[model samples]
Target: MSLTSNIADGRKKKRRRMKSDSDISRPSPMQSHIDACVSFKDKQVAARVTSDAKMDEWFVVKVINFDEKTKKFEVLDEEAGDDEEGGVQKTYKLSASCIIPFPERNDPSGTQEFPAGRNVLAVYPETTALYKATVISTPRKRKSDSHVCKLTSNLLCAYLRGYLLEFDDDEEDGALPQRTVPFHKVVPLPEWHRQRDLCIKMRLNSEFGVLNM
Candidate 1:
């Protein structure tokens, strides 16, 4: 065999070895934590964008697709309207580290649905801790009710009519005050609250603690 032919054969063998090593080092799809939680066509969920400088900002998005091999997702941002001329919608391809699912209550069918008057825990903007609140109202597409004169001159009420939230914490005299907050800022309570409320309800039931007589 010629010397050039032998050199070419050696180079081909090295390339094959490198390819085999890469395949072995690659992580399996099942091993990815992001793939386990993500599902295509899942209900829209609130996710905080961590990849940007504004990490605290949250947006509602639906999972369009999941790349199990890459452990990434293609999400459709419902809040971000399509471009003019009805172009492509606002979508993002982000890794799990760049997104976090918000705490939300899901129905048995895996749909996130919250109705008005539902009790929830919400964090107001610039607040560090969650506060007990009730969903008084959600934003409507049409203005059904006529605007009333403000009892007090508050600039917030003048411009935007946000989500109406009634705080569970009341005054010493038992007066609960309601405040308007942006919808994205509000989220469902943690799991601990749900379990605690369940226990309290069971304890109050008549047959809960009755001894067998």
Candidate 2:
């Protein structure tokens, strides 16, 4: 899918009466009790989608459509020729748990430039799969002349400069070495995880009487 097609201006389109899928619509009671959270229609975030292969590989997808009533999402694979045979981008209907949302870039917790040692999901080199990576360096500005998008030459010159990342699974001596991934291909963790983590930390602090200090 084209970038423009994937990113809309937040104007609501005509609502489609989505039907609830029995399997994905409701989370198990135990799962709900483990972590109760709220869902938002306004969550503007990209998603990491498991490929058709289900081989632990994924591609970054925008234009996320979540149906709270059904607890499911309709995500578009923005990668060109991502369809089965290589023609156009493909769409997938998946359960809520299947979609992993990226944190908003405007979150007050951090800026687009993630600090060194920050954990992130980044696209592996020459592949659509995303992997956990540790930021070794902040992004640097770089120039580009690629005409992939419909932008002026001057405007296109400022494509993102990928930061240095050491993938988590690369602990072995001959694993994929540290590499760079453009800003567009990297993203922070979802808000739900961040909230849960903070809550856990606070609970631990309270148990230790650290909060009373």
The candidate scoring highest on lDDT is: 2
| lDDT for residue 102 in candidate 1, whole number 0-100 | 47
Candidate 2, residues 134-211, lDDT tens digits: the string is: 888765334443664345333223334456899977766777577887765677755654576589789998888965
In model 1, residue pairs whose N, Cα or C atoms come closer than 3 Å (at least 3 residues apart or on different chains), thus clashing, are none
lDDT of 1 at 86: 71
Looking at model 1, residue 183 earns an lDDT score of 48
lDDT of 1 by residue, 97-204 (tens): 544454323211232434688776555545433466787775442132345315422332322344677876544467767777654456665455578778778877
Alpha-carbon shift of residue 151 in model 1 (angstroms): 27
lDDT of 1 at 10: 100
